[model samples]
Target: MIPITMIPRSEVQKIEKPGWVLVFGRRKTGKTYMLRHMVRHENYFFVTRGGLILEHEEQLLYPVFEERIKNLLLKDITVVVDEFQRLPEKFLDLLHYHSPDSRAKLILVGSSFSVARKLMERRSPLLGIVRPVKVGLIRPVDLIRGLFKLGISPELLLRIAPYIRDPWIMRFVNPGKFRRSDVIEAIRFNVPALIGEVFSEEDRVLTDRYELIIRALSLGNSTPGEVAGYISGFIERGLRSQDVKSYLANLLRMGIASRTQLAGRKRYLYSIESPLIDLFYYLDTKLGYYEIDVPMEELENLASVKEGTYFERFVVDLIASLYGARVQRSLDPEIDGILVKKGRIVAAIEVKMGDIAREEIIKFLERAPKEGEKIVVAREGPSLEGVSLLTHRDILSMAMNFEQRF
Candidate 1:
């Protein structure tokens, strides 16, 4: 399996100090894989998930940890506790107590909501001492490079294949002899062809859930209520208490969908992650048609809105990931995106799917702090007053820029 953890593994090598480091990300995003890969040669213990060892008012889970510290006497030796949040709160105290003069490092990895709340919220033991590492999904670059490393042909890679959003589709298809049956089987099963290395249990669950969600999203149900109804109906024929919120939260954590709330109504639009899914939802399917297939022109028009929205979301995710630990995303009425660095608002972006007037741009720009940069992002060529206007192409280019910059 390809070790994508090499990126953080290289970064960890540069840290000589014996300080604590917390590696966190949504479940199935490869946090544990990175942690284990980084400390392979070092003395490390993999703690059981959702399990903890504790004593009265203290955590002795690391009972032999002190002994290992003296025995190793090495700067790079580290201990990793997978699913650290599943353990009781005392686990943090144990790590801190033994960290005074030892060269041993602590690597904590867990999923979203639980771990993020503990490490980032005020009054967290992990606060101020731990460095946060976030792992996102396989990027297009990573996919291309990973496939090449596996000796897959470039010609096969360039095929105008249906975007495979599901994992089960990889099971039956061979390298050559692609056919309509294969595509139908894939659509029926909802599995993608290529697997991002480092498959985990949580990853499988997410892949299945995303398959269901994308199907619902393809049926003209983009809003939370619509998606929720579809999923709830699909799962058990009825929606349970908090079923919508629970499934939506899980999908967001898995990077399958994203949420953005509109004005006056607290309702959010839960968009599918893949443009292929969007195309399947809008372009391929027709509603109550007179037995005629959608034409190229109709397909293109249907695709425009979904593609535009996907592009906007791509820009938001790019900025959020690249400038991570520096920026925060908010869905305010006027602002489509927000950037906060060092806990202060530094920039705001308004997303426009198509041509928009300068007056709307001004209203959106008003939401940003006067001291920070204000910009409008759109598909059409940009125009705005006193604010930087950037096109969809420019917005994507900015992601690479931030990748190189701070």
Candidate 2:
């Protein structure tokens, strides 16, 4: 067994608010771990699917467990319950009547995305009682800062750093033995299980249509038209572009997919959000259902080609979020992304995972948007004559600022 490294979750501070808290996020983003370690509670319970509750490490039936929770809350003691959705309606009503008035601070953590949203509906008994805390994947900057503590070099770190966002990868990333293959290995084992759990939590079943769309996005078909076309090739019943767009909305809300509008057009581009998820689906597509038996060398070669694209996206997302801005992809093939804040374009960014050539920089200079700031980000390269050059060193600065802000 491999030891895991623990990092502070920046969202924990939000749980410190005065009233009750409802913490929810996709599974494996570490919601349970954060609430267990970072919050103050007098009693902790884990509710099982069959209505059996494990309180203080002792299992009890619904009646006994409900009474214990009531007694603690009435005594003004804080309480935490993981998988609160699994409990009966009575448990929710118990809190609806008691949580706000009682001095007890209630921190409930749940993984079901569907149920979590239902709690905010008009008829919910606890609708206005608890503050909602959403936890997403490890922020790019926070993940970078944590990995830097392992003394990993900047260039090598960029190669596999995105995989570390999945909490399961924490087990595979040993300080001295870590390498790109180590991450790939971790993905090989975890991706299927992770996808299943996420879908299960969302109360979704992956039909053939869902798989086709996910695979299409993995292979770089980002537009709804492209996805519809791709799926048509695989099935007799074809979906319209508008239908594809509607389906992608659920994924965007769940944080599994992301979309960026075209710079000047109303159309959008879609892609998988998690790097591990992207790579896994890419491998599944390439192997044509032979993913389980793919050779390590073949898997490594396939993953290498997509690493740069994922890295470019990471830079785009990190930079855009720093300014509380939105990112748009341009129609020009040469331009990667544009960051916009309050309806004004602030920068046009070009990210190169490999060395930048003078001719390449010159080409970018000629084609990139002139009204906004011009910037090129690379691992290591000579300075451009007129553009801002950012490197992993600069990213470190951003990472530090990001941690402090959260």
Candidate 3:
């Protein structure tokens, strides 16, 4: 087995201080893994699907668990409750009441954004007492480092990184050993389990509509009108743009999807937040619900086409994150990514899966702000006058350099 280091997250440092800390992220973003690394195993309480685990072996009942927490806090121990959302609101109230007097620091970790939002609502017991920290996707530099440690080639890593963005998935992947059959196997074995765990609670309230919206968005129907129009074709009832907008809003709140708007444009484009989730939807669409057995070659062909677009989006988002930039879609010249910083256009970026021509680079540069940088990110690209050309290797190096500074 390859050794991997816990990429020191900034939030972990905050946990050392006193008071209540609420750490949240979608499942497998490394919330529990990071917390377990930072705190002692005995100090951590892992909440399984069955419910809360107390004192390693014993399962503590609800109200009784509250008393146990109070007693733990009185002892001035740093307590970590993983998936704290599984507990009742009364448990939170208990923690809130005891927090001020006790020396113990409370760290509550949750995977579901909806649950976290409800817990931190204006009327909820955890509203004022807790500090929220989101555990998102791993940094590009850290991801690169981990893959390198696993003996994955730079070229292969770039090709596969887009599909397996989550560290939880990436850690298990071996590029050297990967085959076309592995894609189908992963989708067949892994995707269902992840969907079941993450969306089971959501399914209770959302029904099939949520899956329909996801399918629509994954198919490139980004606007509210486009989503409603596409979804209308499938469902029996008439669906309005407003209904799609409301569903998109719920997705945004749930941290499953995000909305992007251009600097001057009024229209917003909606897309799923997690690349892994997007890949899942893409595969689902290709294979369909009833198809039990798909040929490996067919799955490979479909994945190749979908992964090209995924790679571009991954590159754009990684660049944006590095520069602390907001992504904007430009209309006139049709730039792939507009990087804005402090309300000014810092860079205009064009992402291509293959090598970009000199003329194409010049055209993009002409549309970009004169004072701002113009960049073209591709697999292989030639140098152009006044334009920054970055290859997959160059991007990884940039991220590595940035990680060193951090």
lDDT order, best first, reads 2, 3, 1
Compared with the true structure, the alpha-carbon lDDT of candidate 1 equals: 0.51
* Candidate 2, 134-209: lDDT as tens digits: 8888777666766677676776666666666666667777745656677677777688788788788898887788
Model 2: weakest 10-residue lDDT segment is 1-10
For residues 1-406, write the lDDT of model 3, one tens digit per residue. Answer: 1233534455565565657788887777778878877554336776676665665678777666777777888766778898777766577778768767887778888888777777778898778888888777665555665565556655677666665556566555556775544555555566656656666544435457888898888888889899999888888995899988988987886667878886567788898876667766777786863256666677768767767766777778778877878888766667788888888888888888777887878788877766568889877877987888988778877766663432
TM-score, per-candidate, Cα-based? 0.48, 0.92, 0.89
lDDT of 3 at 288: 69
Which prediction has the highest lDDT against the true structure?
A: 2
Stretches of candidate 3 above 4 Å error? Answer: 1-18, 38-42, 49-52, 62-64, 202-206, 369-371, 403-406
lDDT of each: 0.51, 0.79, 0.72
Estimate, for each residue in 1-406, the C-alpha lDDT of model 1 and write its tens digit.
2235322322334332346666655444445555555554354445555353332244444545444445553465665656666555675765555556656576666655446656776887667777766554434323333334434333343231123212223345543454333433343213232221112423444354455566677665756567667677656566543556676676665555666544334566666654444555444344311134435455445444554455455455445555552334455444566666665666676766666677777677666657567867665544755788876456445543443321
- Residue 252 of candidate 2: its Cα lDDT? 79
Top of the candidates by TM-score: 2
Cα distance off (Å), candidate 2, residue 91: 2.0
